[model samples]
Target chain A: MRDIIVVAGKELREIVGAGGGRKGLVRELLFIGIFGLLFPLTQVEAWLSGGVPAAFALMVPLFLVGPHVADSFAGERERGTLETLLATRLPDRSIYFGKILAVCGYAWAVTLLIILASLLALNFGADVSGRGGSPTAGSGESEFFVYPAFVWVAWGVGSIASGLLLASIGTFVSLRSKTVRGAHQAMMIPLFVVILGGSFGIPALFRSLPPSTQERFTELLESMPAVSVVLWAVGGLFVIDLVLLGLGARLFRRDRLISD
Target chain B: MTLAVHTEGLSRRFDGVTALDGLNLAVPTGSIFGFLGPNGAGKTTTIRLLLGLLEPSSGNAVVLGRDVRRESQAIREQVGVLLDSDGLYERLTARQNLDFFARVARLSKGERDARIRALLEEIDLWDRRDDPVADFSRGMKQKLALARAFLHRPSLLFLDEPTAGLDTPAAVGLRSELVSLAREEGVTVFLTTHNLLEAERVCDRVAVIRQGKLLAEGPPEAIRGGGKRKLEVTATGIRPALVARLMNTPEVIGADVDSEGRLILALADGAETAPLIRLMVETGVEVSEARIAEASLEETFLALVDEDLNGRSRVESASGEHPR
Candidate 1:
């Protein structure tokens, strides 16, 4: 555990702390501005709604994790630092796991921070518009207009799951990539394909379903509490994460890495 | 003497291309052992196999009394390595790089701090310890890497071409530091290099390898003096008849006229030079100088490699392959 944390600490410093310097912070600020402030401000009603905000929040980890993991895994090989790392006394599992943990942790932190920022932006948007119902106005009688409790649970859990998913996929791509640029290029294509397919294919498949079946599905979904569905999704994601990390473990042997 | 590293019939083959052939060696503890080989020789492969970064194809190795196959992690805990490249983290400050490796070696926080400071000061990079490695020159980076490798105070170190590509002064400085480290700390160093001069200067023992096979292994002086006697004759106006007569002399085993009109002769044991000079004088060769001297490490290495290649060629011609 100490080895893992020590490795992760170095990684955090390299990717998000002083080692990354101003550019890393600037990238995070840009991400926060777009996802946390601008998007939420433009769609206050959608932000409160369950569906769009969940997708919106998932994007934060989806975008952040790929670069971090690709650089952390493949960059070490390309820059030749992995050789020295492998020559150390640390276990291979500790080293590999530590890298994955850092990327996921950083991405998840940024994801949660963005979610909180969006909430503030939404409430602040209300104040800016001189809306009287927001709790931020400091009157106890005023009610807070926020996303429902179920949505909060989905946003937090779903973003974490998304971060883990992206990190796993990045590890797989980085295993064969000789350079970080190659890993980045390889990661970007699949992400775009998933984004495009999820955007177009899911709706098309729903539309293709028989009208009666579609109505029954919608009815069944609406009748279930949002939190129950979220729990199920989270469970599914957790299993997938385990399987992917297992595959990574099988391939991440120290000898094999050096040979490759 | 106790052995720090021992190998018996160690070999590694990649896709039917043998990178390292069956080899046997033993390196004494607390000695600077030089692995001398040209490019494409199996020096790196041997290092990897001994370090257990590579598993052998046929035989096994024991490092620090632990089988590399079963106890590579344990071996790694007590050893340091420097590759051909510096392999430093460019974005991290020099101190951070050392700190990270020190953490891996499980040094206490206080010890790591003091060690890092002392190493930086020793390498004359203390003022720049806080600077990111990418900002430093290659020489500075190499020095910091050396510090990192020594951070845990390992009893043994594997340094692969640590002085390659450095300017003369930097190479000299690094070599001196390496000597000091080994001597002062009682460290056993396995240094690999093609720089014969560097090996000659720094190594207590050297093994010459070519085409994945060791040609010779001994102290540098023994290797230089191992073969038959050699005599160099500097003369003007030496005829081919004179060279032929000298080769036919009882004292001379083989003879050649260098491009500069000097005679290089391989001699039998205890062969006197007076007879050879007398022959040269009789053959209308004005002998200016005749001297017997020990061969340099570079000459000995080249001769060893040349002998191996020529022997291989002869075997190929006589049969289908060579066995050594």
Candidate 2:
């Protein structure tokens, strides 16, 4: 556990901390500002109800994790550090798990922070618009504005699960890729497939369903609470995350990692 | 003396190409043993195998009293390695890189701090410890990598071409440090290099390898003195007849005139040079100078590698296949 954390700590510093330099920090801040402030401010109702905001949120990890996770193994190899890492006394599992955990943890933190900031921004905008009926206001009582407990919890868990899933996939790609650019290129297709398929393909398929079938599906969705669906999705993504991590571990051969 | 490493018939093959073949060696504890080989002569492969980063194709060996095939991790824990690559994290500061490896080595926080400081100071990099490694020069990076390898103070060290890229001063400095490290710390070092002079000066024992085969293994003097000593006499009155007579004599293995018209005699083992000089003088040759010198390691190494190449070429031509 200590070894894993030590490795993760170094990795986090490299990807997000002072080691990332001014350009990296500025790029990350820009990304956060655009997604967490601009997008949410432009679509206050949809951000609260969850449609375009949710899709944008999911897309955030894909873009952020793509560069960070690709650098996990492939970057080390390119920089001639992987062999030394392998030669260390740290267990193979520590190095593998440490990199995955670090990348996922960073992506997860950024995603959650964006979501919270967007929520706060939306609420502040509402209050400024005089929609939040404050008791001090001459008009009556200002309604307290908050996303339901279920929505916050569901989004938190689901966002983390989604980050882990994508990061794990990126880990596998990075482990096999000879260069960081190669890993990034390899991840693009699968990432786009997941983003486009989950957003447009699956929903379009549901729309194409027979009216009776669509009604039954709506009934099923209605029968299940939103929290339950969120939990189910998070749980499913977590399982896939585990499988991808396992596959990554299995493929992390020291010889193969260093050899061409 | 206790053996630090022992290998018998340890070999490795990559696809159809043999990288190491029938390597048998025993390195004494606390000795600086040099593994001399050319670029493609499998020095790195041998180190990887001994470190258990590689499995042998047909044979096995023991390192630090444990089987390399089964107890590689145990061996690794007790050994330090510096390969051809300087494995330093570029983005991390020098202190951070050492800290990370020290953590992996499971050093206590107190010990880690002390060791990192001491090593950095010793290598003269303490002032720049906080600087990113990417900002370092190649020699500086190499020095840091060397420091990292011994940061844990392992009982055995494997250094592959440790001084390959450094300028003369840096190489000499590092070499002296290595000598002191071995002597003071009692660490057995297995260093590989093609620098014959460096091996002669720094290594207690040396092994010459070519084409994945062991050519010779012994102390520097012994390897240099392996064959007959040659005596060169700078005389103005040498005769062709005397040269022929010297070549036929049992004491003289061969005789020839060098490009400078000096008498070069390949004397048999334990042959006296005084008698040869007297005989030359009696034969009306003015012996201005007579010098007997042992063959240098460079000469021996070149001769062995050339012989191996010639033998390979012969076999390849007969089989109609070029050797890799």
The C-alpha TM-scores of every prediction are 0.91, 0.89
lDDT against the true structure, per candidate, is: 0.80, 0.80
Write one digit per residue (lDDT tens) for candidate 2, span A1-260. 99899999989878874434555587767777888889878877666665555555556677777778888889988888887787777767888889877877887788777877776787676543443331222333544355544455555776667777778888878888888889889988778877887789989999999999999999998899766866776798789888888887887766556444
Candidate 1 residue-wise lDDT, A89-178, digit = tens: 889889878988888888778877777888788766744333422224344545455655566666678777778877887888887789
- How does chain B score by TM in each prediction? 0.91, 0.89
Worst 10 residues of 2 chain A by lDDT: A131-140
Q: Residue-wise lDDT of candidate 1 within B46-89, one digit each (tens)?
A: 98888888888987788999999999999999999998778898
Q: Give the TM-score (vs. native) of candidate 1.
A: 0.91
Clashing pairs in 1: none
Clashes of 2: 2
